[model samples]
Target: MARAHFAYFHPFEIRFSEVDMHGHVFNGRYLDFFDTAVTGFLVARGCDEILSVDGAGNGVDMADAAAPVYFVRRAGVEFLAPVRFRQRVEVAVGIARMGRSSLSFALEVHGEGEDAPRACGEIVWVAVDRATGRSAALPASLRDKLAPALLPQDAAPASGGA
Candidate 1:
């Protein structure tokens, strides 16, 4: 995908701790990179976290909230190339789909100064109630905030109207 299409981009330095015995970034580290990018995205939107909090930066007690937090229902990543320690990567995040109680994200990782992505992935999250740990509907506040990142088709299923 073209860089212009992404609404958010974060640059990350590959830490030595993330390197594996194979001398390349560990496969699992890709998920961590994705998580960091997502958190940055949420913070940029004035939220502490997705599915909970009012973006106040205060650590709210999710267990007592009306709706708690988002739980990752599924995640998958495709490694297109290897990355070595001391290298820097740029992560581009985009909202792929939003539902009543869920949202999907697309992530791409590009080596610094490179034009093509070295890795790509998708994450599906579902909002869960803090108390019962059951799924809950998404609040309008979040939907509105995320609207700018959604493509035309991606926004269709996210309509709150019954």
Candidate 2:
């Protein structure tokens, strides 16, 4: 897919702590990068309320019957190249798909100055009834806010091993 398809990009500076003995970023840290970018995308698109905490600040207010909470149903990462410590990178985020109760976010991590991504991945989140924990339709408000970032179904990148 063309990088232009991404409507939001969150940049990050690789820290020494995130690098492994292999002299590159630890493979596991990509998930953190994706998670952070997801939040930024939502906020940038005016859906910050989706991640709002409860009044008590205990958590996502799973008790609120009117609010649906999202949970990570699946996550995958395909590493294409090694990212060294101190390298600057950016995560491009876009909505790959939106289902009745789930959202799939497509992401690409590109090192600064590189023409291609160092990694690509997808994270699937399921919306569930706060009280019942069962899948629930995504709120219309959220769907509306996120519509702008949704990619054409066929435009999403193919998922697989690196």
Candidate 3:
């Protein structure tokens, strides 16, 4: 609910189509929401600068001479709660760890509830050379933009309880 120093905050609006026959967001559809939010999540931290888009609306890699950056892996996903139709949500993202060619992310989704998370998960991404198709070092520009992901912060303290 509060801004976290180590986390990048991203706000998302729930779409009407995200709902399913049951009148709630469909199980499979959450992935799409998560993904869209993730891109925005990256963009907020200046990651959009590295998507390698063409002069047109596509990933033609005009920035790196046709080299594409891809998500080579995923660590895990922990679902916390279901989101109903049109509920506004905020995605909190932070890097759990970083490696030579990868960065691990921890994501949390917060809704209009009084307490608790709507969803949360961890994702690991590897940098690969589009030409070689092999893992490569993350570029300096991207690394600089994602510098916030490298800071270490403590967890939220426990609240009052019996």
Candidate 4:
């Protein structure tokens, strides 16, 4: 994917705890990096606070809610290169598709000054009813705020084939 396509990036350092005995970052850790990037992106856009659903499925304040939080429904990743310790990786993420109840994310993990990424992939997340754990429509306000960071038309093929 082209670097210019992504509008959000979160830089992270490779901690010693993240590396395997072979000195390369563990495969599972890439998911952590992407998760962090996604959270950062949403927070930066002020969308995180919208997740205040209560156990009864009503929208409420986080301080008074015990909602079932957002959950990843599916994720896919392709490791392009091995990332080792002592390196800073910049994870760039963009919204590929936003649906009534789901969102698809495209992400690229790049090392400093590198043209190619250490890894690239997509994650699918579904908003769920807190009490039932079933899919729920995403709030219009949240989607509107995230519209500016959606991937360009050519970057990912959106499903609403209209």
Candidate 5:
């Protein structure tokens, strides 16, 4: 759990379902947006899609691979701005560290180029043994693919990001 940060970027759109009674995206929806961007970033880096394969094409053939499921063990998020209906946003996701049983990420969210982040968060990932659903090492090949995208800096550890 030493610090080793690596950064990445991806884009998304705000949807009506993501909003709350206040007309702004609900606090929880940000996490979904964060996941969308992170998934996209990892796919671009050639990692097997952990969640789905429909949009990532058959190159990695996620469905045919020995997929390892990851569970969020911890997260730390800071909301800096509000996102309203129909706004498009982009998030930058970075790995701040990698450990034997887990990995850490830094996420920066923005309204697609407004010069300021709408939010920033840290995410922690741990591979789980599919059958037992307990902690395990991230698969070596997948780790190799994801390693190149780790942020070039470091930060204090955050336990998880869901």
Candidate 6:
């Protein structure tokens, strides 16, 4: 896919601690990268409050029954090339689908100055009622805030209910 398709990009330096014995970044670390980039993307989109504790960084009170939260329903990554320590990379993030109770994101990890992505993946996050621990329809406010990041219709994932 073309880089132009993505509207948000989060860059990072591959840290030595993330490398495995094979000299490449550990396979598990990609999920960390994806999570970080998605958080950054949400902040850039002016949805930081969703991630903050009362919007004050005080941290969430697990006891709050009404607190909103999202649970990861699925995640998949496809590695195309090895990434070494100290390499600069960026993750391009785009919302591929907005279902009644979930959001699906498409992500690509690209090396600096590279035309192709080193990896590509998708993550599905489902909004859930904290008290019930069940899927809940996404709030209109949150959906509106994230709508701008949706991929163009032609490039979006195949339609289906989440």
Clashes of each: 0, 0, 0, 0, 11, 0
Looking at model 6, residue 99 earns an lDDT score of 97
* Candidate 3 TM-score over all chains jointly: 0.74
Question: After aligning candidate 4 to the native by TM-score, how far in Å is the CA of 20 from where it should be?
Answer: 1.2
Query: lDDT winner among the candidates?
Result: 2
Question: For residues 19-103, what per-residue lDDT tens digits would candidate 1 score against the true structure?
Answer: 9999999999999999989888877866554524555666665444674478899888888889999999998887888998998
Per-candidate TM equals: 0.83, 0.89, 0.74, 0.82, 0.74, 0.86
lDDT digits (tens) for residues 102-149 of candidate 2: 999999998876657889999999998977889999999889999899
- Can you give the lDDT of residue 24 in candidate 6? 95
lDDT of each: 0.78, 0.85, 0.64, 0.78, 0.70, 0.83
Tell me the lDDT of model 2 at 59: 41
Error of 2 at 120 (Å): 0.4
Q: What local lDDT score does residue 64 receive in model 6, on the 0 to 100 scale?
A: 36
lDDT of 1 at 17: 98
CA RMSD of all predictions: 5.9, 3.1, 4.7, 5.8, 4.9, 3.8
Best by TM-score: 2
lDDT of 5 by residue, 72-115 (tens): 88876777779898898877777767888788877877776665
lDDT value, candidate 3, whole model: 0.64
Query: Is 1 or 2 the stronger prediction by lDDT?
Result: 2
lDDT of 6 by residue, 34-142 (tens): 9999988987787755686444445665333564688899998888889999999999999989999999988888898776788888899998897788888887888
Candidate 3 per-residue lDDT, tens place, 55-79, comes to 3436654565444476749744555
State which candidate, 2 or 4, has the greater lDDT: 2
